[model samples]
Target: MKGKEILSAIKKDIDEHVGEKVLLKANSGRRKVMVREGILEKTYPNIFVIRVEGNDRTSRTISYSYSDILTQTVQLVFKNNNVAI
Candidate 1:
């Protein structure tokens, strides 16, 4: 797939999985990575949101673009089957 096509495909995949539990892995730069468990919240034309709960019981949402997935800067795995979405 071309760049735009790939991004659109990623968006569609996430759209189909909205409201499901997901494990997120994000690269934070300098060889650091952040991992979190969250619910696939919403998807906009340009980005998708995930609702994550902190260890302290506070919940917050994070948003990432489909291009992030295309570039492997972020990854989403379905919690049910341990498969990357």
Candidate 2:
């Protein structure tokens, strides 16, 4: 799929999961892989936010743009099935 189409679909799925729990897997570098379970907080025009809880039980929000998802820097998974956008 074209980049734009893929981005749009990702946005749609994010909208559907707002306020629901999902897994976010991000790879910033070879040794910087991050996997967190969070609630899909919201979807913005150019970005989406997730509310992740830390080991200490503190919650924080992280925002990633569509470009991030499109480039595979961030991946969203629900119920073990990766949301392929």
Candidate 3:
């Protein structure tokens, strides 16, 4: 699926499971790594970001945490035809 689709899916999943635990996963990419890292950058204990990937293309997924964050669910806002923060 496209990045926007993936992000929307993630946002929905997060809202559906509030106050619970959730996991995010994606294929190998610099953007994926950045998202994982950003999620980990929590000042206080809240959410957790896990990286899950495989050596081969057939098995690879990067994950992001949504249940821990307190912000409202946001869609994958895009700018310049690319994923926007």
Candidate 4:
């Protein structure tokens, strides 16, 4: 699929899991990997956001471009053990 098509699909996938917990797996791009469990916050035209809370009780928002999903640079897992994006 083309970029726009893939982006649309990713957005739809995210929308489906709104208000649900998901696993976000991504490489920090510096040889380190980061994985977080958070609620699928919201989806935008260009990017989607996740709400992650650290052990210190600090909540942070992380956003990723749709391309990240398409390239598999980021993986999103639904609570049902299904891969969303």
Using lDDT as the measure, the top candidate is 1
lDDT of 3 by residue, 15-34 (tens): 44333222332333454422
Whole-model Cα lDDT of every candidate shown, in order:
0.91, 0.83, 0.33, 0.85
Report the C-alpha lDDT of model 4 over 1-56, residue by residue, as the tens digit: 57678788778877888888998899788888899999888888888889999999
RMSD of each: 1.3, 2.5, 12.8, 1.6
Q: Pairing residues by index, what is the TM-score of model 3?
A: 0.25
| Candidate 4, position 82, lDDT | 75
Superior candidate under TM-score, 1 versus 3: 1
Top-scoring candidate (TM-score): 1
**Predicted candidate 2 versus true structure: per-residue lDDT over 1-85, tens digit per residue:** 6877888887887787778778888987977989999988888988988999999999999999988877789888875455543
Clashes of 2: 0
The 10 consecutive residues of candidate 4 with the worst lDDT sum are: 1-10
Give the lDDT of residue 28 in candidate 3.
Answer: 38
User: What's the residue-level lDDT of 53 in candidate 4?
Assistant: 94
Tens-place lDDT per residue, model 1, 1-85, is 4888888888888888888999999999999999999999999999999999999999999999888898899999998777796
TM-score for each of the candidates = 0.93, 0.82, 0.25, 0.88
lDDT of model 1 at residue 67?
86
Give me the displacement of residue 59 in model 4, in angstroms.
0.7
Candidate 1's error at 65, in angstroms? Answer: 0.5
